[model samples]
Target: METKFLVSLMFLQAIINGVNLLRPPDQHGSKCSKNGDLNSNVLLKSRDVALDELYKSFRLPFTGAQRSNNGGIWAHALCPPKEKMEECRECVKDTIDFLKKDCPKQKEGATWSIFPHFYCMVRYADHPNQGNLAEWAWVQFNAPPGPGNATAGELEKAWNNLANTIMEKATEVKNLERYGYGSVLYGPHPQNLYGTMHCAPIIYQM
Candidate 1:
């Protein structure tokens, strides 16, 4: 009985560790202007206003919007699909707090966080009406564990097929929220492969 209990505990610990590894890090990437042309104090004040507006309106059920202040301070916040109003609000709040603490005096900054069933993003810049289509920066995370006996070529083919499918579905007009999530099964044991894509609303207009 003692040995069985110990084995169970070990298995539980391994599962917990795997989950922790999958969770997004507290901070991904940040940038503070090195040229020092932008005024951090003014930007900070404007950021506060923008964030407040975003937090209030973004909490509305089944709605998404962008916020900006007159002083060239703009912000965009978003929560994953199917999130409830309260869950979205809380996620945005946490994201805002994390960015403010992690990236101080940054003319432009953005952060992404992944919770159990959802993810959120917070971004701000010292420019007005900047479209989301612009590709300022990007970040990549570790991939999940692969199939136990899949060949290198087989894995590549599976990944490519998954990526193409996601892109087609995510870009379709039916995806009003500009967010898509799906999974595919492949390989001998047929392991599940999951993928998600989200595009800011501004991109659709462009």
Candidate 2:
């Protein structure tokens, strides 16, 4: 079934001429349920089992996990195609720690983080169809005005072109990697503008 609620933390970063143009308003970008059902031992058991399996199965750049039985928990994790094994594991571990603290009672959670060496995402839900785009929520980060004399119109045009190209390329990606990246020239100074995108390896519906 489709997941009913979603909690996601997405980070976006844009750099130009050694200056960061995009930053998250909330560094944590954490979302959690206000009230937790701590006394629900069944749910707690399912959550623990699901998380354990997720960590164990998180070998590939993209992976998914589900409880051995129908405990109603499913999880997915992702790292950049070129991410190192140790770095990806560390990122996932840190992300899982954040979810355990910030979403203590939550049935589902997702987080995206980009580090200097690697980037990753961890998502878990009680529903099986977590791959469905309709079950996802998004947070947008707006970049500040272009540095120097570049107008908003010019910036938007360059960004749109780059974004569109990246998205299309991402769709064309095949096999398990499912990632795409590109860069373009921008502004009067002609600094480089870069973009990247990824899609889940597979989708399941129930």
Model 2 error, position 67 (Å)? 11
Error of 1 at 91 (Å): 0.6
Tens-place lDDT per residue, model 1, 25-76, is 4533333434243466676787777776766775344643345453667777
Instruction: Name the TM-score of candidate 2.
Output: 0.69
C-alpha-based local distance difference test score of model 2: 0.54
lDDT of each: 0.56, 0.54
List model 2 lDDT by residue over 1-206, tens digit each. 11112111111222233245344423334444333343587876776666666556555433322122237766666665665666667766676666677667776666655454355666666667665543233434344554456667877777677766765665673634555567777778776666666565453542
What are the root-mean-square deviations of the candidates from the true structure over C-alphas? 11.7, 6.0
- True-vs-predicted CA distance for residue 163, candidate 1, Å: 3.0
Please list the residue runs of candidate 2 whose C-alpha ends up more than 4 Å from where it truly belongs after superposition: 1-28, 32-39, 60-70, 134-136, 140-146, 173-175
Residue 148 alpha-carbon offset, candidate 1, angstroms:
2.8
**Candidate 1 error regions (>4 Å):** 1-37, 59-61, 64-66, 128-136, 142-156, 186-189, 203-206
**Where does the lowest 10-residue lDDT sum fall in candidate 1?**
9-18
